[model samples]
Target: MSHVGVTLGVMAAIPALVEPTMLRWARQTQGYSVLAAARKIGIDEDKLAACEAGYERLTIEQLRKAAKAYRRSLAVFFLDTPPEGIDTLRDFRRVAGSESGEWSPELHTEFRRAQQQRDWLIDLLESEDTPVPTAWSLPSSEVARLSDAQLASRIRSHLEGLAGSSGPTTSDRYAHSSFWVSTLEDSGVLVLHTSGGGVATQEMRAMSLYFDRVPVIVLNGSDAVRARTFSLVHEYVHLLLHADGLCDMVTTTRATNPNTALEARCNAVAAEVLMPAAAVRAATESLRGRPVDEWTYERIASAAVRFGTSAEALLLRLVNLGLASRSLYEQRREDFQRAYVEQERSAATGGDFYRTKARDIGKGYVRRVAGAHRRKVIDSFTAATYLDVKVGQITRLAEAAGFASASGR
Candidate 1:
């Protein structure tokens, strides 16, 4: 062999010297099968099996690849044992038959990301001796006791600033969801929208993490803006109940199923919050005597526009209020579902980096981290890490959050 070729072969033969159980633990915790993990690391399945079994060793390059695939730091593999982390979220997605613990690796990543963010928020608040938001003053037991309408009324009163003098805002759909997110954040809830490389809409519409201090809600940004508006409120309700779960929000309201019941309660609360019964009645008063058939698709879409919610959601509300028949809702909802299925998948928009980052991690979080940095509570590198941006971009991120650049500090 040539001198360079021999050197390369020698380098490739070097072992990573990580524990075999660590490799296996990382793969299993990440929900990756041996074959899938091998494919992700660009190695053969048998080789991965051997490495995990301690029968063989992987090169440092291969170990790095495995680390990337498993979303772990390379140094973690050298630890005495795998880190102990449990799946704290209760799965509420309605699978066809038996419960399958299998979840997409993306979901596992999101779960960890949410937990890390929550922990960061806790630490930040503790450093400042800040009390938890008053929005959570209403305990979960009291929240559970109140009927949906009562809870909805309370929420409306609490967030009435969003409605202004007229009523629900106009058809500026994106602004609608943004407004809710911002308001929730002000109420001491950290709201995050999943950016590119996040979980798909089908796998999860949204999830909530309940904490007494600073609760968190994550929305699947891939869904339609209107859909996300509903999901935001739905997850908000989940927080009110202090129930944290990985949710699909499939709109299955049957009470017989326990998971469905919880989802139904959240859905019902969301409906009342967004489409107050009194407002819905006023909107449909013009057609009081008309048959349910008169509620055409175009009309439903028009009405949904005012509330910045999906026509399907609006229709379901009508059925619940007895303003429309169940049969009519089912038929129209089927059409809406079909249209949703046919809708083109929204590709990630490439644009100015600062605005996108601001939207992803949330303006409230950005402002807080920026304020902390400005006060010398966290350094530039720490601020950048919290905001998921480069240190160079910290100035722009603060600006995006409407704060002056504090990178000079």
Candidate 2:
């Protein structure tokens, strides 16, 4: 073809006419600056800037690349404006003292992903004519009327009933985080764990979505198991009260402080459930007469281990219960916080891939999908989709969920 004909053909290539505002919104909301987004999209930085400024348009291929880079659907860009986003969850972290700040894009992404998973679960159960179990809740007014000890005792009894034969009271291993998660799952709560990418333990220990049915709790998998147990109960309290949000688990304020009263209540409830007032008192009976300053670190740590809690949490509860001095707790708080930070920073680095995936996808969820596959209600591809794994990995996932494969491998 002649040069003129070839040039004409090239000029007719389609352009992706995305709204500049939408492009900018997607990039910014995902925590990507223009330069970083351009790098990820494999485009010139100036070109991306120009596109966002409405001075340029992207080719269809380039826009596809942008969609992948932004972790958004290609169809979202065609809308007249950016759609109303997922901003409804309350930001409770602001009350967490100096730790209050903006969440990372990773956290935002995980929140969106978790909501999607909840929807998927609902739909999956519905397709099978199975009713999605509704999680029990207490009225906010009723919750407010109960004392921390009273509410904690009620919740502990409820969980023990749900756990039935495998309850903490009967099993030595109920101290494990997995036991708490399993018990919550049995009670119809969808418990999830994060991959620990951008949701740092300091930023958010856990978050809950308090739907009337199938409330969801996403724990920071990078945290220590014992710490996660505390967060699990704390977030569970949020679900019970029908108050949902991202939480840092920093309940330094007393319940009297209006701003963080809810967080404080949740923390108090978790402490009481894990370390009952009577149990704690009996465990520390020998140290009762000692001055708070004289209560050795070894004694505090030993008691904490029995309850599957941190030394700091046990110490603070002691102060609250008049068993330890507030001044002593304040003196040791920084050291405890520093050590936890270090532990979190070094978490979830290397692990067996299947087991890690199983944890991220809760064992209960994995079992449901596996059972469906076994019953031939869902095919291999569908099972893989539900479990978020490859078709070949379904068997391994089943094993990780603590059962033999349907084929008995």
Candidate 3:
């Protein structure tokens, strides 16, 4: 192969100078050490160190290898110096008495990736002339005027028509979460249900990010369906108010503080969405004639099933409606969470790539990327990069996403 003083063992080397500052910038931006970055790119540690120190230059081929390992383009290695990194998005998951941890590496990667996807779609929507999305940014007080029950009724009506759930019926674990996810997507909310890194221990339940006039929700796919469903609607509430942040409000609650008033509102919205006061009153009319003190775990779970909600959500509903005392509800919630954790441990893994990414990558996002590819707006490589999947899997992934969107619509 003809070469420009450098060889890649194939096509001619594209004439490019790999700036040492850029090399150091890329490695540092991703929080990688010299030795670690070298190992990642399969390069000699000493050689990489020299490049980063500006003592030696990286050949075009070596630069390409480094670029691939860093998940960046070769042109990035040619920057004059170092460029600033992506802006940090807002984090609104903090609640009183809870540790508000910063983003983990996996979560940070996923967050940045999601933001980039949002960026891509914003460009696409503008060029394609997509209609302006309706933002349900109502004053929280006004929404409460209809009473929480009435607002929930309206949301329920919206969700029922948002997507027609017909997959595994009540038997499947993903039934509830799938239903909400479809409904969310159908209502123009982009839902991403990945496990972030798919790591079990540090899995975040869900997070919402608003961008370019649209809201995107990311749910942890590895979590149990019960918990994921709670997260889904909780984030839906955040999206409604155009509030952007991360949260893990799965199976629990915190005291209402003016500082975290939004979390409280979103929490209430989630509870009402899943089990409104009207529905709760109707369902618990028989139990009410009895006594709140007599409510049992089995009873709460049974009631939860009717509303297609989790026992925790149902318990919260009961407490909010004063049908059950706070003391009893908390006690039952503790028991419920323990049992639920054990059940999740024994339950099978959530879903495979097709079922998971179908919702995880988000149907709204998948269709836009797929359509972009078809229109030559983006190539397969770019599509796969944005999807965090292999190039060959693009078509199948797109099909699954399309099917999901169609099912929801």
Q: TM-score for each prediction?
A: 0.86, 0.87, 0.73
lDDT of 3 at 74: 78
Cα displacement (angstroms), candidate 3, residue 11, comes to 15
Candidate 3's TM-score reads 0.73
Q: Write the per-residue lDDT of candidate 3 for residues 290-350, one digit (tens) a residue.
A: 6666676667667677666667677777777776678877677778878767866886655
Q: Which stretches of candidate 2 lie over 4 Å from their true place?
A: 1-13, 85-87, 95-100, 139-141, 165-175, 196-198, 254-259, 291-294, 337-350, 403-409
Tell me how far the alpha carbon of residue 117 in candidate 3 is from the true structure, in angstroms, after superposition: 2.2
Go through the candidates in order and give each one's C-alpha lDDT.
Answer: 0.79, 0.79, 0.68
Kindly report which residue pairs in candidate 2 clash with one another. none
List the lowest-lDDT window of 10 residues for candidate 2: 165-174
User: After TM-score superposition, what is the CA distance of residue 172 in candidate 2 from its true location, in Å?
Assistant: 7.2
Better of 1 and 3 by TM-score: 1
Ranking by lDDT: 1, 2, 3
Name every residue pair that clashes in candidate 3.
Answer: 193-360
Writing each residue's lDDT as its tens digit, candidate 2 over 376-400 gives 8888998898888899999888899
